[model samples]
Target: MKKKTPGDVFDLHQKIQSELNAQEEKQRSALRRSLSETKAAFDFFTDLGHDSTTAIALTDIALANVLEE
Candidate 1:
C-alpha cells in the first residue's frame, strides 16, 4: 500500500470541515425561519383574541422562549 502525505490528510480534513460548516449554516437558517413563522402565527391569534384557552398563552410563551434563545 502507498503512504499518504500530510498535504493529502490536510486537504481531506478541510473538505470535511467545509461540509460541516455548510450543514450547520443550513440548520441555523431553518431555525430562524421556523421562529419567524411561529411568531407570525402567534401574532395572528393574538390580534383576534379568538380563544381564551390556556393553550394560547402557552404557545405565545413558547414562541417567545424559542425566539429569545
Candidate 2:
C-alpha cells in the first residue's frame, strides 16, 4: 500500500468535518420546524383556555424531566 501524505490526511479530515456539519445543520432545521409547530399548538390551546392546555403543559414538563435524566 502507498503511504499517505500530509495533504491527503488534511483533505480526509476536512471532508469528514464538512459531512458532520451538514448533518448538524439538517438536525437544527428539523428542530426549528418542530418548535414552530409546538408553539402554534400551544397558542391555540392557550387562547381557547381549554383543559388540554393544562395537559400540554404537563406533558412539556414530563418531557423536560425525561430529557434531563
Candidate 3:
C-alpha cells in the first residue's frame, strides 16, 4: 500500500468534518420542525379555551428540554 501524505490526511479530515456538519444540520432541522409542531399544539389548545397558564408553562418546558438536547 502507498504511504499517505499530509495532503491526503488533510483531505480525509475535511471529508469527515463536512459529513459531521451535514448531520448536525439535519438534526437542527428536525428539532426546528418539532418545536414548530409543539407551538402549533399549544396554540390549538389555547384557542379551545384551555387554561393558558398551564399550556404556556408546558410549552416553555418542552421547548427548553428539546433545545437542551
Candidates in order have lDDT scores of: 0.80, 0.80, 0.87
lDDT of 3 by residue, 1-69 (tens): 999999999999999999999999999999999878888869976887779898887778767887799
Give the Cα error of residue 20 in candidate 2, in Å: 1.0
True-structure Cα RMSD, model 1: 6.3
Report the Cα lDDT for residue 34, model 2.
Answer: 71
Per-residue lDDT for 8-40 in model 2, tens only?
Answer: 999999999999999999999999987886767
Q: Choose the strongest candidate by TM-score.
A: 3
- Cand. 1 TM to true fold: 0.69
Rank candidates, lDDT, best first.
3, 1, 2
Model 2 residue 49 CA deviation (Å) reads 2.3
lDDT, model 2: 0.80
Candidate No. with top lDDT: 3
Give every collision pair in model 2.
none
> 2 or 3: which has the higher lDDT?
3
